[model samples]
Target: MLPRPSRLTLPSIARWARLNGSSSRAASGGVTLLPTQEPTPEANATLTEEEFSSMIIHGRSIYPPLYHPRTHSVPVAQLQFRAYQHQFLDLYMHFVGHAAAALGIPISRPVYLPTQRSLWTVPRGPFVHKKSQENFERKVHKRAIKAWDADPEVVDRWVRYITRHAMPGVGLRVTQWKRAPLGIGQQMVDSAVGQTRLGSGAVKVKALAEKIVQQELLVEENADTATR
Candidate 1:
């Protein structure tokens, strides 16, 4: 049987209202259709027409785009996308993976994070009856993609392109890590000493900070090694 269509988005909800009689209980779903066209249906006896157009599907499908292997192994940046509807989030994420592949960017595997859920309870009726309480829940879906060994400029361009063509109801967050040269703190410490006779306490503090930074770099290297 073919996969069921998603009705989480506003347009899909609108389509559902149009297809199913609005007088039914499902009429609560709004009606909003997009300009894009759906694929033509196939001839199959096992699958009914209605199920092909609409039905309940658990663990929706996620089609990831291709990635071109590159020599760059360090993770330069990451992208986090979220939406109330998983369908929209996954669709846009798929598009981003493909766009990056087309540009020859080396991206890591797509990461699916846990869904965040919020709940509320209130009295169903005017009377404050404990037995007549109402409950409501809202869920936010999240997904992330990380690019490795790609040029910072290329990553910036990809981010801009995605922002310009972002879909409705989805939010994007970007984070980047800058690589620093080794032993760069020595130059700063020397310059400070030349400018003024710094006390031993200040120099000791600077050395301690530099040691912490070096330890962090080592931890990152260990983590990268483990992933490989």
Candidate 2:
């Protein structure tokens, strides 16, 4: 049997119906739109973490996602979601956090960034009242979720899964850091010349302060002995 569609899918299905000029009836070829199923309050309230996770995997959960405890604190990736509505954005991010946790990937508490507002004024007026113009404003809410101490492959899978089941009206952006090579001096050291990357410029620098200090002290001692 086919899986039941979630509440989030209702809006899009209705939109398609309208676009196909089918309002009180099914679309062309008897393509009937399935009614969205919303869980009752009792069921919603009694949802366990496992139940919620299953529903969320199908994009059908009503309650907010439960966050898992962080296992590792090292930040590996960050996810940011932007949407005009804060409720859906927050819900979607929490969903991602919960899924990552299921994969044993630690996640940080979401960071609530400032809402960005944009206002536009046009020459046209409301209802052809050209004498007076109106101003319209839009606010986009942003939230950031970070993955901590997670392997790159795990993070990638998490992202891929979330992308496949993306929530409507939400925009997702991901930022990930490249892993550094293992062991000491493996990242930027040249074994032959003993040089390392210094700053962002082309200037070459060596960290030999201790050796230089010892050489200067020995030179001073030699000078004193020669004077003696």
lDDT for each candidate structure: 0.71, 0.68
Write one digit per residue (lDDT tens) for candidate 2, span 1-228. Answer: 135446444334434434544543444355445445642444334444443343323334443444556564678888989999888987787678667756767677789999999999876756767777778999999988887787899889999999999999999999998677676565344542445334432342243666688899999999999999
95 in model 1: Cα distance from truth in Å? 1.4
lDDT, candidate 2, equals 0.68
Task: Give each model's clash number.
Answer: 2, 0
- Candidate 1 lDDT over 1-228, as tens digits, reads 244343234234344434554454444454333324442233133343333223332222232344667585888889998899998997888778766865667887679999999999988777556579889999999999888887778888889999999999999999987687898899888888867757556778899899999999999999999999
Candidate 1: give the clashing pairs: 14-31, 14-32
Return the top candidate by lDDT.
Answer: 1
List the candidate 2 regions with Cα displacement exceeding 4 Å. 1-60, 125-130, 184-228
